[model samples]
Target: MASSKKSVFAAFTTMEIVLMAMLATANAVMTTYISPINQALNTLGGPIATSSITGIYMIYGLLAYYIIRKPGTAVITYGIGGVVQAFMGTAYGIASCFVAAACYMVIAELVFAIVRYRKWNLGVLMIAGGAMVPIWFFFAANMFHYTKWGTSILLIALGVRIVSGILLCGLLTQVLGSALIRTQLLRRFAISRGQGA
Candidate 1:
């Protein structure tokens, strides 16, 4: 187990899988309840409820990184969220939902691949956050019929996603992770000795 922990292939146990399922379910419910507003907000922010929650998605990847820290753990988290969101979100029978989600998985996986599955490092975290790049360009642009945002516009959007991901996932989720470690629920993943603040 210890050897596995250091590898990027570390997988979530049954309990952690169930726990992520629960968290995804909860987030989806909240997302659905706010669908109308979320829709409008997404439009205002650009499209597809991105940038804002892009970090939230990164947080999931970071969680998986903490546990598995492997080559595919980050990818799996993206897929898990996609499936869970589909199960819980309105989706409205729109094909765009599936396409956008798949795009997210692909792009996020690329970011993790570039970082070689290290999420604790700031550069890796930034790369993970930057994974939203193609999602906005390819998915939102082509699949959703969005107006062609120029390179400058795209950079700004990417910046929002990266910052959001770093703040929410890298920082906030780190707090949650630290707490869990103190409780010993996550000692296998966390190396620190003190009870996390």
Candidate 2:
């Protein structure tokens, strides 16, 4: 007999959507509130400029993916995060949100797919999050005039993004996720399901 267990889904369940929404919304609020601080950091120039706080934006999506362990979770979570951020109002406006959502989600999904979604370990998660930066930079270059910064500065920004991805999205997310698992709050989700908790 075939096992009842199945792989990731193309579509999410209602519960999954709700979970994603909550996480994404919280992330948006945090991100929006911190925008000014990050902008001020940008004035300082070099890697510190772009690397200041934006990495935290990746938190919700990374955590959602950890819990859901599903194919489209990253996209839906991050996309909703972008919508939430836009609705909450930001200096970058809605267009930036849409572009960011699209770019980050696409790259995140691709990286997750490449790993076959079998690995939820730190390094894999870091790679998935880091993968998003190139597309982020691509769109940001167009949307924010990164070209004016010169190649060296742009490269530094890229390094900052990758480092942030690993630290904020990967490491911090992993630590938080493990804590959530221990709380048994996620018992009904994929993470717990996998753990047989």
Candidate 3:
């Protein structure tokens, strides 16, 4: 038990913790700015427009995981982001922020776990990102009465969200991670330690 505790503690170094905190704070602030855009999209194109950008909401957590390459990276990042969002306030309410965070964390961790946390390719990251959407989508559908939109529309929204997750969350994470690595800013992270950019 003592060894297990130590191992868990060692999983996150001080630098990792600091980076996660910064990313979480960024996530909260970005959500605040993005919320207005999402609201506008909801008004103009309904669920489809908002769904197309849903991936952006989940990117910070994925980027954290990508950089840290650790078991709980995404979970910790999302959890902190949820807490920060609660304090910062959200259009969807504090509870919804947490729910969305939980959903993203669970799916991302599951996807990474399935790969034994050994893969960091674009395909794997895309799979993780795209997989994170459906659970929250269904939950939000029920909570927001989107079920009344008919099965075809619901499926379309879901599809758009998945693709958005692939491109915006996963692909963009790789892009940003690579960019950071190129700048040598992430030299201390696992990704820069010969883990491949």
Candidate 4:
């Protein structure tokens, strides 16, 4: 009788850990620059800034998940990135980014778990990206409650964020992931090893 081969990458390798750390740290540094730009846009009457920044914030998880495809990768990457950003003293405060990253990953991880992590197509990406909206609102409402922003403005912001998440994080990630797959740079990962499915 022939025995089936156990998956070679059931556990993360050192290279994978290094890749995760590099990506997470890069994400944290990017946040330091992106957040101020977002605030500036908001001041200039650019309400869509929320959507843009959220999408940008979400890219790290999307990229990390795409490359790693391991369970809990999103949570770990986002958690580390968030902590790093908070410690770096982003304008939004450490607690805000920390909570935001935690919530975003929770929603994303739940969707991935339900799908058994099999589907990495556009539709699934869209769902995963869009799922962060509720968490965004939860955190935003808490932070902005003292600002006394009207319901109409809040609704507009939510709408913008949803659309942005779908486009920037969902569709864009799919496109970028496809590109990455084509470049053969991800050959070391399971997605290139025919084990992603």
In order, the Cα lDDT scores of the candidates are: 0.57, 0.79, 0.89, 0.75
Extract clashing residue pairs from model 1. Answer: 8-69, 8-70, 8-71, 9-70, 10-68, 55-165
Candidate 3 vs 4: which has more TM-score? 3
Arrange candidates by TM-score, descending.
3, 2, 4, 1
Query: lDDT tens string, model 4, 103-178?
Result: 8789888988888776777788888887877786767688857236677777777877877778788888878877
TM-score of 4: 0.87
- The sequence of per-residue lDDT tens digits that candidate 1 reaches over residues 53-168 is 65654465455555444455545565666676776656544454456456655765676676555445555555555555455446555554444666666667666666676676
**Clashing residue pairs, candidate 2?**
none
Residue 178's C-alpha lDDT in candidate 2?
91
Q: Write the per-residue lDDT of candidate 3 for residues 83-118, one digit (tens) a residue.
A: 999999988878888889999999999998787666
For each predicted model, how many residue pairs clash, with residues at least 3 apart or on different chains? 6, 0, 0, 0
What does candidate 3 score in Cα RMSD to the true structure?
2.9
lDDT accuracy of residue 42 in candidate 4:
80
Q: Estimate each model's TM-score.
A: 0.66, 0.90, 0.93, 0.87
Q: Indicate which candidate wins on lDDT.
A: 3
Q: Model 4 misses residue 37 by how many Å?
A: 2.1
Off by over 4 Å in 2: 1-5, 195-197
Indicate the residue-level lDDT of 145 in model 3. 88
